[model samples]
Target: MKSKNSLIPLIFSLIFFHSAEAICKPRGFDYIQPSSNASTSTSQQQQSPSPSAPAPNQVPSSPPSTSTPISNANSNPPSSEPQPPSSSSSSPAKTFTPSPAPPPTSSSRPLAGINLFNQPTPKTEPTTVDPAVKKICDSTDYPTLCLASLTPFLIVGKTDPVSILELAIKASTQQAKLALEAATKLASAPNLPPRKASGLSDCQYMFNDALDNLESAMDAIPSKDYGTVNSMLSAVITDSETCEDGFTGQSPLAEFDDKLRMMGSNCLAISSLISPII
Candidate 1:
């Protein structure tokens, strides 16, 4: 009885609020309801995907991104399609065969290089002084002396008795002149006895005679006068002997005198071999 009017106004306000709230709310088309008042509610809300985020099952319209391959120097590349090897890789490299060198000829020889074979040097043969040296020396009185002295003077193959005799006389003449010089020096001594001084003087004169005879024989030998050369060389030996006899006991010129006679004997012997060169 006291508040009937206030209750009436409160009931009007609640009805107005429910109507206005329903009109102002945005409608969700995603969900469908069988009745307006009886709406179906779930524990989780199912969200529709945006344009930026794709679903797991959906395929991309554009191509997938490709990854770049890493290169390694030591690693071998994998072969594709089980391919057969090309001719360049599978075949052997070409072999180089050098041409054989030409044989060495007399006209053209290879240049000298290192002596790999260690070849020995060629040996030279020994040679005699002359072809007729042994034959001529074997027939002389002093064969060793005659060969030794005449071998240096003779031609290789020539043999003439006159020429041999001339060489002999020349050798003998040299020895005789040496003796003469010795005798001449001895004879000029200041305090020499009359006997030794006279003997030395005689030796000098005899040696001079022997040398003159030998020189004459050499001149006569070129003309093939073997008879004159033989006589002259024989006188040369006699002159040397006479010089030796002038001294009594152990003469100072005994060695020279003996050598001169021996040389004179060789000249005499060689002159006898001359056959007049007809």
Candidate 2:
């Protein structure tokens, strides 16, 4: 029990000692607040604008920013210059000095005596039959005979009929020659072929008929029997064509063809002259 009482006093003493230590601690710490106030006052003094701030505002009454004079600046903007006129109006109008036109080159010159600038081109020099051709016409009547007789032979070949026919036509003279030439050409035509039974009998017949008519024609000319000559020629022509449908290649026909052509030029020449007389 005594020990318990002493223990109680000891606890009370500890409580009292704690209370006094707390009071002393507050007394020692009270000085720190004043020091903190002093530091706050020093900060305020450092942050405040000094006397120099008002002096800068007060010293700047010299000139406004906009009113300042600019140095080394252009007074005016650059301009474009006007161009001079090509021709002066006061002076006489400038003459255009045109280069002279070159003369016609030799290559451009007209053929023969024809002048490009002058007289209406002499009607293309009337395409006269060649002298050689005229001589053929004048020499004999056989030229027509040859042309007429040979047409049958030619037509039997594979060459173009139109061109062959044209050649025969260009060589033809007199009614008999023309008829014979036409008949032979048709009978012997390449396109027509050797369809006849007698091997170009029609062509041969026509050629023979032409020959007969021409003979009769020449004979009649002496007597001035123009009618007989005409009749004979017509009959021969008809007879010659009658056999055309029957023509088939045969009978050494090539020989007869050669003979016919050999004599045609001479025969045609004489016949042509006689025909004009008739």
Q: Highest lDDT: which candidate?
A: 1
* Model 2 C-alpha RMSD to native: 24.1
Scored by Cα lDDT, where does model 2 land? 0.46
lDDT agreement of model 1 with the native: 0.69
Give residue 231's error in model 1 in angstroms. Answer: 0.6
Question: What residue runs in model 1 are displaced by over 4 Å at the alpha carbon?
Answer: 1-131, 155-158, 276-278
In model 2, the worst 10-residue window by lDDT is 116-125
TM-score of decoy 1:
0.51
How would you encode candidate 2's per-residue C-alpha lDDT over 173-208 as one tens digit per residue?
233343444445445556544465244555656676
lDDT of 1 by residue, 3-108 (tens): 9888888889999987886775568744443354443222112231643454566544555567779879799898677877786786777899999988767336
- Model 2: what TM-score? 0.23
All-Cα superposition RMSD per candidate: 22.5, 24.1
TM-score for each model:
0.51, 0.23
